[model samples]
Target: MFKTIKNDLPASIVVFFVALPLCLGIALASGAPLFSGLIAGIIGGIVVGSLSGSKIGVSGPAAGLAAIVLTAIGTLGGYQNFLVAVVLGGIIQLLFGVLRAGVIGYYFPSSVIKGMLTGIGIIIILKQIPHFFGYDANPEGDFAFFQVDGENTFSDLFKTLKYITPGSALIGIMGLGILILWEKVLTKKAKIFKLIQGPLVAVVVGIIFYAITKSNDTLAIAQSHLVTVPIPEDTSSFFAQFSFPNFSVITKPEIWIVAFTIALVASLETLLCVEATDKLDPHKNVTPTNRELLAQGTGNILSGLIGGLPITQVIVRSSANIQSGGVSKMSAIIHGFFLLISVIVIPKLLNMIPLSVLAAILLVVGYKLAKPKLFKQMYDLGWKQSVPFTVTVLGIVFIDLLYGIGLGLGVGIIVILLKSYQNSHFLHIEDKSNGKHKIKMSFAEEVTFFNKGAILKELDSLPRDTYLELNLMNTRYLDNDVIEILEDFAVKAKERHIDIKLVSKRGVVENPESFIEFFRTRPKSNLSLS
Candidate 1:
């Protein structure tokens, strides 16, 4: 891992810059102490990063958990009480890893997963737009369609337009320009540009801009529009920033309920992000899913003990790590150390970094996730893939992350069912000879009761005085209901003056004794038409 430090170091800096504001934002959104978010970020990077099998994935305090954290904190009576739940959640996630529950992430459809990434991308761009213009009414890291402040996503954007801060907007525009230039030109033109990333430069520029504009009354950005890390006056106060869990709360049944919820949700989000990150990884390395859960469980346990919010492998940070050329988990570990050291050493300097600059950075990340090319690519894959993809995107943009995923999964399942229905079998009619139509119907690889209606309709529509061929060559599993249909159809075919020929691996039979009897008598391999 140390061998990759050359690559990991620069990538870590980019992730550090990206993770800083998010750590603070998600904490603010969760109604937890801001320092708690940094704690989670640190543990996620150092502890979880060490244990996880993923080379490119980054773990941190997830925005996805902000709502749950917010509600759980209130419902459990206090932040200290909620800390108990976080610890318990970690224990449960460990159990999940031992049980190999990581496989659940594999069941999510590709369309839904892509939709999720795209949806989040769009959300980041939309939510950050307000911050980009210095409108900070809604706290950072609140990505829900309906914000806790009672304003919806779109309404807030409209409101931001009315209260745009000139200083913030100017800094944001300049920061974005620098980022774009760094990616498109500077990185290619010089080695130095590759060493110091665009986001870091953008941050430095933002700090200078804040200092310059402080005296301009009309153009000055408010402190609310800057990165806010809790600054302890001294070492004693800094040590006090860490809070212990109220272990007494563990006795409460409600605390366990909250723990289970966090475990279930955080595990799900982690698994999904792991999947997305692996796909984005240029190495195409597959991370051990069960191991990831164990790592996350441990991270959350540590995070909770130190008064941190819940932790998960976040897609945004993971994607940033990959895009910035992170080659190994060292990047994540380094980023964690950055979070640990920076908060203590440069809290005041960090506070001077404009929120708009970070917003500009996220805007780039968002654009990459929701690229126009991706939309076109999904659409080209056809409705089966596109519809669910579109629904997932819309649901995420208009609803919260999990709900949007549920909606997309529902649509994806419907598509699968519809495809199953339509693809039950294929029917072909040969040219008529001597007033007798020759029809061959082939069953699919797996025929179930869901294919019953379509198969029955085709059988019933056979014309009189025809030779009907029932082909089961490709079928691997034939449902009993479908056998019953063919058996019943055999009897009806005689009445219609249709001669039936049964084709199977055994041999072609002319008017087989009974469809069910023939199948029962033959070996499983012989029962399939060849």
Candidate 2:
């Protein structure tokens, strides 16, 4: 791992800059103390990164969990009680790992997974736009369609347009320009450029801009637009910020509900991130999902015990880590250390960095995730892949992340069913010497309602005086809908002078009362078409 330092160190620096604002923003969005977000980031990086099996994935306070955390805090009567649930949630996740439930992540269709990453990319860009313009009403981590403040995502954007801050907007534009120059120009320079990253350079320039603006009242930016790290007056005051959980609420039903909710959502988010990060990795490293769940579970427990919000393998941070050239887990671990040391040692220096600078860093990340090439690539894969991918992108953009994913998954499943129905059976027609046509129809291994359409089409297309032989010898399960369609076709066959013969493992039946019931009476056997 240490051998990756050359790449990991620079990547870690980039991830650190990207993570700073997010840590504070997630805490703010959760309505928890601002320091709590930093705590989660620190723990997510250090504890989780050290334990995680993922090579290039980064963990942190997730925007996906903001709503759950907010509600849990209020329902639990205090943030401390919610912290207890977080810890318990982590324990549950750890148990899930031990139980080997992490394989569940593998079951999601590829289209849905791609949709998720693209959707998250769009959301990150949209969420960061306000920060880019210095509109701080909504917290940096609010990604839901409906914000806790009662403003929907679009309404919030309109609000930002109405209340843009000049200082924030200017700084943001300058930061974006600096980043663009560093990437498009300075990066080509061998010596100095390779030594520093664009995000780091942008941050330094933003700090200087902030310092210059701070000296003049007329050009001053409000404190809200600046990075707000909690400044403890002294060591004692700093230590006072950490809140311990109220374990007395451990037995309450509400605590368990919150615990289960966190465990389920965090695990799901982590699995999704693991899938997304694996795809993002240039080396194509396949992360061990079960191990990742165990690692996340342990990390969440630690985070909650130490007064941090729930942690997950966050896609935004992970994508940023990958884009910044992180090759190993060391980059993630080091960024966590950066979060820890920055808060304890030089929070004032951290505060000097502007939010606009960080927004510029995320802008690059957002672009990389939702690049035009990705869209074109998916489109080229055909409608089966493209439709779901498009729906997912739009759903996430116009709705919420989870809802968008669900929509994409629904579309993907429908596509699969359509394909299955079309391919369920094969029909071959032959003209017999006896002045009749022999039609052979073969059924698939498992026929469901989805296969009914093609089956009906084939049945209805049969010509008069045709001798049809329906084969179900390989079929294991036939759905009720398909059976009904067959029954209706059998009845209509007599009128059309169609002679029907049924063949199965049991034997051949000249005429059957019920297609499904006839099969039910047959001896059980392994049925496979192939």
> Against the true structure, what is every candidate's RMSD?
2.0, 3.0
The collision pairs in model 2 are none
**How would you encode candidate 1's per-residue C-alpha lDDT over 1-530 as one tens digit per residue?**
99999889999998998899899889999999999999999999999999999999999999889999999999999999999999999999999999999999998999999999999999999999999999998877898999898999999999998999999999999999999999999999999998888888999999998898899998788999998899999999999999999998698999999999999999999999998888889999999999999999999999999899999999999988998889999999999999999998998998999999999998998888889899999999999999999999999999889988999999998988888989999989977898899888888888888989888888888889998887877777787788778888877877899898877776677774665577666556634433
Give model 1's clash tally: 3
Overall lDDT per candidate, in order of appearance: 0.91, 0.86
Off by over 4 Å in 1: 522-530
Structural similarity to truth (TM-score) of each candidate = 0.96, 0.91
* Model 2 Cα lDDT, one tens digit per residue, 429-522: 8668477799999988899878888999889988898899998888877776777788788789889988888888766777645544565554
Model 2 deviation from native, Cα RMSD in Å:
3.0
Q: Quick one: RMSD of model 1?
A: 2.0
Score residue 320 of candidate 1 by CA lDDT. 89
Q: Model 1: which residue pairs collide?
A: 472-529, 473-529, 504-529
Report residue 42 deviation for candidate 1 (angstroms): 0.8
